[model samples]
Structures are given as structure tokens and as C-alpha cells.
Target: MEDGKLTVRAVERALDIMLCFTGATELTLTEIASRVDLHKSTVHRLLASLEGKGFIMRDAATDKYRLGYRLWELSANLSKEGDPGIILLPEMERLRDQLGETISLYVQDGLLRVRIQAVQSNQAIRRVAPVGARMPLYVGASSKVLVAFAEPALHEKLLASADWPTGLDQQAFLQQLSDTKLAGFATSVEEREPGAAAVSAPVLDRGGRLVAALAVSGPANRLTLEVMQEQAPLIMEAARRMGTMLR
Candidate 1:
């Protein structure tokens, strides 16, 4: 039992060292030691083990360590493994067929949202949101849906931050979020992109936790306020279907 505990502590320390690389490209031994609160020799030992496993690499000239390609490979593989795109593709296709608008699935990543799947509209002038596109968590219908359904702690943090979308203050945004929650969905008109409008619904898991957002977007001219209001039910139904399948 003691040996197992020691192994677990070692793994945790190693992970702490790796997590120090967040928002940083490279770190020297002293920087890592300071961040992880470990002795230089202990940090060196951990670095050696990580280097051997290709989780980090040491530059020959600078002696600084950076994340290795193996981490990227593992992250990519993990993203692929847990990707909701494959599971949601059929629903997305069905919604696309029904609405004839661009369909996208967005998942939260920290304070940002990423588009994991997108099906472009068949029309010539339709909006296009490509897979892998990232946007702040405070703008657009999809982002608002995520924020509306997110934890209260996250809401407080985001509200306190200086990242509110243009022409919106904290009070107005909070009211908007409240309205979104009450309505069970969100809508935006030229919020993120000019002449683009979208409606989004939250996809929740079995435990009633927000998982992702399903959005349908198109040009504002075609997807006017009335049109979006009319299609709200369809968008929400599709979101419910996706949530059911995911659960």
C-alpha cells in the first residue's frame, strides 16, 4: 500500500510538471521547480523520466524543456476518440436536410468554444463555420447557449472577466442569458459575424449537465428574426435528440 501511494504521488508530481507548460511554450528547470514547488534535483529526475517517455524534450543549447510531439499525438487521438461528431452526424444531417441551413456542434474548451462538426448549407451565400473554428464563450448563439447552461461558478467568472461582446455590458448580457435559460435556447443576429444569424439549443447529458450546443446558421436576410423564432422548435428537438443519443 505504501509503495502504491508513493507511485501515485510520483505520477501526480509528473502531471504537475506537465501542467506548468500550459500557456507556456518552454520552461527552464528553475521555472519548473518554482511552479511545481519541487527541488531542482527532483524536477530534474521527473524531467528525465518524462523525456524518456517523449512527454517532454530538453533543448540541447538552452536546456529548457517543452512539450514533445507525443503529447500532441495523444491529445489528437483522445479528441478523435471522444469526438461527438461521429455520434451526432446523422442528426446534424437530418437537421440540415430539414432546415437547409448550416449546422454546427460546439463544445466548450475553457473560456472558448470549438466547432467539432459542421455541415455547410447548400446555398451559394450561406454562412460557413468550419470544423476546428474557435470563438470566445461570450458571443454568438452557440456560445451563449453554452454559457447559459454552464455551471454557476463559470458564469460568475465569465461575468467578472473583460471579455463581454461588443455593445453589451454585464447587466444586459446577464439578462440575455437569463432569457436564454428561460426560453431553453439562444438566438443571435449579426452578433459574431456580419449579416449572419443563428439559433442554438443546449445538448445536455442524462445527468442534466450541459454537454454541447447544436446551432443552425444562415444569412440574416433569409434567417430573419421571425424565421429563427419559427424554427426554434425544430432546432430544440434536434438538440434533444442529440442529448438522448449521447446519454
Candidate 2:
């Protein structure tokens, strides 16, 4: 094969690895190697480079790999596709500055929540829910708000589907979603990821339609439930301000 073909094949394999994570957000090295049908050594090198470039991240506790934070910075820029989220960048940055934590924007797509934009915190130990990564709609703070504020059809579809991960109490989960909708916000501590906590609120358009869930996430130690509660108003205000910037 020509060198060009080899390079293209290499890029395709890397992309395959990224797509495989859609089904399994957290996967061990062996699991990924098996799923991608690649030699462990080859996959290891790809993962290493990807991690270095902030395209993938490894969980220290579980030794598993997941998506990382740099995708939006690379692809969601204003010029490339002109993502609507760019208009809210100033508000996201201000919230990050005021809260000292990662700020993320998540929009509901069917039963999934995709991180469309984010402004990460400066802390050395921080949570990284990668931009463009698809997350479970029934797991985290952002997910709760997204699901709660979603259209009734999509919301009911989620409630009826068996897509929810095991070990979750469906009854309590339903109640939580109800509360989130009523309160116009949600909070989670180590719910989606261990040692990570987040607070989230719905972003609504001028027509009173849900646009996204704006969130602040960081290490659980720093963003304890109490601290998040105290700062909840800040995020809610920022989310509302961002919503007004949109249609």
C-alpha cells in the first residue's frame, strides 16, 4: 500500500475508536482492544497520543478510558460550522470565572445529552466531560435538567425505554426528574462519575423553550453539595442570560 493509504487507514482506525465509545463511555484497555479488533499494542499507542492531545482521558481510579475536553475547541469554533453555542461563550467564561469550575452546555438529542460547549476550570484536579461527547440522559446533573425539560414525547420515550443503566432505581429517577423540572435545576455528586460533582440549570429561549442545560462541574471535594447550592443562583442567572442571547 502507498504511504498515503497507510496514513488514511491509521486515521480511520483512530476515528473508529472514538465512535466505539458511544456505546460504552468507560472501557478498559482490553475491552477497547477487543471492540476495535486491534492489537493491544497498536491501540495503546493510539490511545496514548489521543490522551496527550486531549482527545481521550483515562480515569485513574478505574484505569478506563473515555472522551476528553478538546473536541469543541477543535471543531465547534465559530468559523467552521458556526455553532450557536459560540454566542454564549462570554457568559460561559464569566460563569467559569465567578464559580471557578468547569462550565458546560449540553443539549438533548433524543435520549442522549451531548456536550456542545464548555469552559473548563483552572484547577489541576478537575472533571473533564469532553465536548461533543454523548452522555446518558438519566445520569448526571446536566442530564437531569435536559431530560426534565425535554419535549414530552422524548421524555416519555426515555421513561419507557430500557436504555437506562442497571443499578438505578427507576422510580426514584423519575421522581428526581420531576423535581428537577419543577425547580428548574439539578445537582449531582459523584452520580455520573466518582469524585466529581456538578450543578445544572435549564437554558430557555425567548419563546420559553428548552435550549440546553448549562452546568458547573468540578472535584467533589471542592464543589460539595452545600457549596454548589450556595452558588446555584450564579449558574442559573448565567444560563438565563445565555438563553436570552439566542432565538
Candidate 3:
């Protein structure tokens, strides 16, 4: 092959590795080699290059590869060109009214979650998270919801790579993610921001891909654990409604 053709083929093979993660979350070297019909050595070389560029990440705990935060960032940028907040605003408003708390929409951006839109509470004392504010994905209810639905490989990668918050060890944190996924929602009290409480649910697109997290947050005193649990269904319902609209 010509030098130019060789370079193009190399790029295509790298993209193949990325494309493998579309419907799946993680893959081992052997699995990737088999799927792509390449030798394990070739796949390993490609994976190394992709990892170097932040297009992929390895979970030390599992020895599996997953799509990295960079990929999420690029995908987010594409989705932001046509914002979901416009379509979700009405539902967010309804949730805020129902709970008398603030409703915010969040999307994963690299290792952080960014608030894209929010409807503040009517009460005098409330948590006000400004749009565009970023928070660690390992902490808040909204962030946790995003992490819960994310690829298991991502969970492993985060545990192995990131500095977890105080009082949350790796196993406990993984269990929290597991529980969140099983319950279809997440709740946090002073996890990310002090004296703030929140309950969040996943918002998925028609294809069942996680599009964002819908959350209701307020002062911790007003939104206790029981209160958050009680309000979980409402937040979940609102997220479902938004997902339907997104579809």
C-alpha cells in the first residue's frame, strides 16, 4: 500500500476500536482482537496509541478498556449544538413546582458533570447551582446518576484513577453505583456541596443511551434522606417524560 493509504488504514483501525464501544462498555484485548480480526499484538499497539490520546482508558482493576472522558466530551459538544435543555425545560419546571425545589439538567463533561440548565426553587432558602457550574462525578446525586448508568468500565476507571471523596472507599462507592443503577435513581446529602441535598434520575435517549441526568436539589435541612427517597419517583417520572420527548 502507498504511504498515504497505509496511514488511512491505521486511522480506520483506530476508529474501529472506538466504534467497538458503541453498544458495549468495556472490552479486553483478546475480545478486541477477535472482533476486529487483528492479532492481539496489533490491537494492543492501537490501544496504547488511543489511550495516549485519551480516546480510551484502561481499568487497572479489570484490565478492560473503555471509552475515555475525552470521547464523552466530544460527544457532548456535538449534542450541545442542538441543546436538550430547550425540550427538557418544561418538564424541569414541572418537577420544580411539584417538589418546591430546584431542578437542574446535567451532562457528563470529561471527568466532571456540567449543569446545562436549572430552574430554581421558589423558597427563600434553596440551593442555587448556576448553569455551567462543574462538579466531580463521584459525589453529587446528579453526578452519581450519570456515573451509575455509564459503562462499568468507566466505574472501574474512576475508582482506580480519581481521588474519591472522604468517607467513600472504592468498594462502598462501587456499591453505591450499583445500588443507584438498580434503583434507577440516586440521592445525596452534602456529597458534593455542603448542606445540599439532591435526588437524580437518568435521562436516556430513544436508543436507551444516557443523555443526561435530571435532578432536584435544595437545602439539606429541607430535603432530608427520607424526603429525597419520597421524591425519587417524581424525579424519575420527570426524567422518563423527558426521555420520551427526546425520543
Candidate 4:
């Protein structure tokens, strides 16, 4: 037990040192030690250990340390492993450019839909949602499509449970889900934001599993009901293309 505790502590310290390299292009031994709250010698030993394993590298010219290519390669592979964001960004950009509206990609993380990618429209008037922001599945168009196409059991669980109360009754929201399914996509005018309207479509993987959602949003006045109906097919097509790429 004591040995396990000691090993855990060592691992924690090592992780702290590794995390300190982020947001820094390069860091010297003293900088790393100060940020990681370890003595210089201890930090150096840990750095040497990590470098030996190809997780970090030291620059001969500046004597600074940076994350190694091995780390970069691993991160790249892991980011694309089950994530649809990487494969969808190119299409998202294309859609944004075509419609002159903001485009976003999101995936369900527990009860929240987390945005993983966004492209700002070039127009002077635009809608913007930052990457990594979380929104409830019950309110936004991007979130609702995922919930609409979700498995029946999971959909019932989400609807029956009293978790997210975005100032709407669950029964009414369930009716909205039915509507979304009928339309083959989800759309909202000022549901998430006061003056923004959006249309969203689901991205299904090769296994026909719901992987993510792609949404295009803009000013409500411009995105009328007729306009949304017209644009819905385009958004769905873009998502379908992304799904093919992911497969």
C-alpha cells in the first residue's frame, strides 16, 4: 500500500510537469520547475525520464524543452479516433462560406452538447458560438437533432427525467422532438439566443450511430421559416458528406 501511494504521488508530479508544457512554446528547466512546484534537480530528472521515453525533447540550440513529435503524433491519432470534429471542419467551413452564416459542430457529452468546431461567417452581421461551450440538448437546434435521432430508450430517459429545465415543460418538448423527426432536421428561431435562428442535422457514422451534429446559425430576421426549410437540405447533405469521411 505504501509503495502504491508513493507511485501515485510520483505519477501526479510527472503529470503536473507534463501539463506545464502546454500553452508554452518552449520552457527552460528553471521555468518548468517553478511552474510544476518541484525542485530544479527533481524536475530535470523527471524531464530526462520523459525525454528518454520520447514524450518530451530538449532543444540543443536554446536549451529549452518542448513536447516531442511522439506526443504530437499520439495526440493527433487520439483526436481523430472517435471524434467527428476533424473530419467535419472542412465541410463546416464550406457551408459557412456558402451561406454567410456561422457553422458549428458538436457532440453529446453526457447530457450536454459540447461544441468542438466553429466557423465565423464573413458577413458583417453574424452568429458566433465558441468551441468547447456546452448547451442543453433540450433547447438548441444543434442539440435537439442529436436527441431526436437518439435511441428510443435513451430518448425516453432524457424526456422522462427532470434534469434540464430550460423554461419549458417536458411534454411540450417531446412534441417538439416528434416535429423534428418529421422534418428530418431541427430548426429554431431564438430558442437558444434571442435573435439567432439555426438549422441542425445529425451526422451518422459508418455503423449508423449518431456521431455529432452540424448547425448553421445566423440572425433571426434573415433566417425566416421559408429560408430555413430551403437551407435544411444543404445542412443535411453537408453532415452526410462528413459522415462518409469519418467512415
User: Which prediction has the highest TM-score against the true structure?
Assistant: 2
Per-residue lDDT tens digits for candidate 1, residues 128-226, read 777877788888999889999898887898877777555667777888889999999899999888899999999887778898999999999999999
The predicted structure with the larger lDDT, 1 or 2, is: 1
Work out the TM-score per prediction: 0.68, 0.71, 0.66, 0.68
Worst 10 residues of 4 by lDDT: 75-84
- Report, for all candidates in order, the number of backbone clashes: 0, 0, 0, 0
> After TM-score superposition, what is the CA distance of residue 21 in candidate 1 from its true location, in Å?
20
lDDT of 4 by residue, 1-247 (tens): 9999988988898888887764477999999998988899998988998989898899999999998888777866674665567767888899988888899988887777888889998888888677777777778887789888887776777766578665688778888888887887998999878999999999888788888888989999998878989999998898888888886
Q: Which ten residues in a row have the lowest lDDT in candidate 2?
A: 75-84
Summarize candidate 3's per-residue lDDT along 33-135 as a digit string, tens digits: 9888999999999999999989999999999999888977786666444478878898888888888999999999877888889999999998876887777
Q: Which stretches of candidate 1 lie over 4 Å from their true place?
A: 1-82, 165-167
Residue-level lDDT of model 2, residues 1-247, one tens digit each, is: 6999989988988998888786677998899999899999999998998999999999999999998988767765548343557888889989888888999999888788899888988878888767778888889999999888877787678867788667788889889989998877899999977899999999998989988899999999999999988998888888888888887
Query: Where is model 2 more than 4 Å wrong at Cα?
Result: 1-33, 36-82
Candidate 3 stretches with Cα past 4 Å from truth are 1-81, 165-167
Better of 1 and 3 by lDDT: 1
**After TM-score superposition, what is the CA distance of residue 34 in candidate 2 from its true location, in Å?**
3.2
- Measured by C-alpha RMSD in angstroms, how accurate is candidate 2? 7.4
Residue 231 miss distance in model 1 (angstroms)? 0.3
